[model samples]
Target: MSVIAVNDGTFVSELEGKGVTLVEFGAVWCPPCKVLLPILETLSEEYAEGLRVLKVDCDESPVTASRYGIMSMPTVIVFKNGEPLEKLVGLRPKSAYTNVLGKINAEAARL
Candidate 1:
């Protein structure tokens, strides 16, 4: 699956009130942000059962970006129960995301 586009309207209810949310804040102009799209998509597909992966374009959704203090481009925030659990800045390997998903899955299993 592809990354879901999120905005101020849906950010809170969809991310905070729901289950795990992996939100990526980025701008279309950023090269690194462009590069991370595929990885986000892959991760979204891999964890579709338990995780909600979305993208908030900094240009399109400034309110959501500022709410999270997104100073840099391509900031990845992982949220559980509406609060942030992890923030990954810059470009990272696919394994970096899978590791986080694995951890969340383990925790979910325990719960």
Candidate 2:
């Protein structure tokens, strides 16, 4: 599925269900945020069965950004069961993302 663009109004509801949700907090003008988009898209496709990837434009969603304490561009947070599990700041390798997902998947399997 395509990455859903989330705003302050939709942020909580977007994260309030079953499955794993990956939310990327970013701004339109941030270069690293631009760089991370495709990487997130690819991961979203790969984990489509169990993952939901969403994006929150910090410039447009200040309330959501502040709620999450997002102090930098391209901050990726992994949420499971409506709670954050892992956070990554700046640009990172695909493996960095996969590693976090792997752990979440494992935990999910145990439940």
Candidate 3:
């Protein structure tokens, strides 16, 4: 499935009820953002049942970026229980995301 496109209006509401959400704020022109695409896609597929991955195009939706205070491209925010738990900036290894997911899952299991 394609990454869900989120914007200023829908981002908060959509993520509020969802148990966990991973949001990527990027633009098509950003090289680092492009590089992170595959990683997000792979993780999205692997954690389809538990995690929700969404993308916001900075160029297309500046409001979303501003709302999140995203000053750079490819700002990844991990939200758990309607609040941001972790954030990653720039190009990072897939492990960065997997590790976060693991933490979320582990904590969720204890709940």
Candidate with top TM-score is 2
Question: How many pairs collide in each candidate, listed in order?
Answer: 1, 0, 0
- On residues 25-100, what C-alpha lDDT tens digit does candidate 3 reach at each position? 9988999998998889888898876788889998888887887799988999999877888989888999989998
> Clash pairs of candidate 3?
none
- Given candidate 3, what's the lDDT at residue 16? 88
List residue ranges in candidate 2 displaced over 4 A: none
Window of ten residues with lowest summed lDDT in model 2? 10-19
Model 2 C-alpha lDDT per residue in residues 1-111, reported as the tens digit of each score: 878998999898888975799999998899998889999999989988689999999999999999999999899999987999899988999999999999988887898
Q: Cα miss at 11, model 2 (Å)? A: 1.0
Cα-based lDDT for every prediction: 0.86, 0.91, 0.87
Which pairs of residues collide in candidate 1?
A: 16-82
Question: Candidate 1, TM-score vs. the true structure?
Answer: 0.90
Residue 21 accuracy (lDDT) in model 3: 87
Report the Cα lDDT for residue 103, model 3: 89
Off by over 4 Å in 1: none
Using lDDT, rank the candidates from best to worst: 2, 3, 1
